[model samples]
Target: MNKKRIPLPWTNVYGLARTLVALGTAGTLAASSAETLFRPVATIGDYPSCNSTTAASLFCLSPDDYSHLTWLKWLCVAALLVIASGWRPRITALPHAYINYSVFSGIAIADGGDQIALILSTLFVLPALGDRRRWHWEQPQEQTPETRATRLLALIGISGLITLRLQMVVVYLQAAVAKLPHAEWQDGTAMWYWGSNLDFGPAPWLDTVVGPVITSALGVALMTWLPLVIEGSLVVSPLLPQWLRWWAMGAGLLFHLSIALMMGLWSFALAMAGGIMVLCLPLGSTIRLRADEDVATVDTSPSQEAEPPDPDRSAPSVEQPQPSR
Candidate 1:
């Protein structure tokens, strides 16, 4: 009897998710100066050497000079760009994770987004290591038989993905539950206060458009409580049906987009958007490869009964077709 082939974990769904994360981070770093990102003179509490002591950060390996640090920052941007391009996942996975770690550890300024990026990038390494595809966006061809080693690797990748899902649940759950104890969130005036804040609030033009709604009692209640509801719903989204999961994905993305518009936290919004995709998007979903229409015809059935080998039949080719660009 033939063994059922194990599906590889690297799919276009995850490919898009990781690409968003890489692009968001790369955009942020590429647009900023090294001086703004790295401190000119390292204090005892926050030093460039701290990154080295904490982990094998690329930035830490650079010489303690402004020019060297700038060059290092560009190097990270290039690596992230490669990751965003959906190139060889096996080669870029660890480098992507390392870049995030380096930024989190060495950057003078960072936020929750940076923390999330670090975690996601690290977890992505598991699936990437086992993936045999040239690009992450390519679906595994059905003709390829799974070897014992490949099956084991796929299992490891699935475990990592499940862990990532649970982590996202915890993140959303914590965000909602933590807000319950706060007076602003409780009284439904949180949106008002946040909108009117001097820093990190809505821009002047945006405030003009949304100012009235945020200040009103009804709008404040809806704006404030809606986030809690949405976040709470996301925490339990894994238990939801596939259709509901898609809705949750949409709602979660809209929520983050609003945050980006209101508070100018583009990187944060992008990071959370990626987290939402991993949490709610089904892993089995595949992208339609226009160049390779045959992918759609590939049988993904879990098991099929095998027939006895015939001496007259020839062995199938071991080679696989090249994936479409």
Candidate 2:
């Protein structure tokens, strides 16, 4: 096929995606930790950690020690703020990633959202480090050695983003796959059981309001099959139409929103939504090289010809004065 392929603004696309994931991580971290500030370890007891004498090597201080850990938590919060502000990401990104890692390693109980934030925070920093250029939204450029080098670096950054994006798709697909062996999912009655369970279901008042509708056979089937199909379809996003891809991503966003509202899995929902932001990126522009025939046609076109001068509109040329010897 003699199809002409256009170049994409990979660096800028990575930059835009990184900005969103960073900001989303920041928000998730802040929201998740907000309650901890009001209810300190002193009041709620220490977070379970492996801080015994033998495990002392794992962490410097006792797991319960709030002295340094509290300060570290605040530091992470500050770093996240700086990153979200779009201040020099090269500097702040490392610290933000480190803090997120520390939250999981230093603490005993880390939410699934923490893992999501940590993964994104770490991956984004690589692109930020490699990207020495500013983000731009402008006309595509002609290829040059310098442009090629820039694109190469951009490819490196984009590779990481692509890895993360594909990883999310795999995770969702795996979840659906795993459920295939379960009778509830196969029978389309899983949502009914989930909604009926008091421990994991909606609150008492909410259950009373929405219980009957959600627990019905049709409701259960719809809820179960919709997510399975939606998540499974994401794997083939590139093959889908552009508008359909967007709609899929948007549906994923709403799915997470519903999870947060009904299931109270806010962190997981936000984290998943953050990853979907990558798929939601607008298509980058590609440079379309003109064919030789098109170029020749353009060159010969009437628009390329100079207009004939009008005698009345033309200015008279001045005669040169001759110098006498």
For model 1, give the RMSD to the true fold.
Answer: 8.3
TM-scores of all models? Answer: 0.84, 0.68
Tens digit per residue, CA lDDT, model 2, 249-296: 778888888777677777667667767766544333221233664562
Q: 151-223 in candidate 1: lDDT tens per residue?
A: 7777787678778899899999999999999999999999888888889778988888788898789998899
lDDT of 1: 0.76
In Å, residue 291's CA in model 2 sits off its true spot by: 36
Backbone-clash count (model 2): 0
Q: Each candidate: what lDDT?
A: 0.76, 0.56
lDDT of model 2 at position 282: 32
Cα displacement (angstroms), candidate 2, residue 145, comes to 8.5
Q: How far in Å is the alpha carbon of 255 misplaced in model 1?
A: 0.6
Using lDDT, give the best candidate's number. Answer: 1
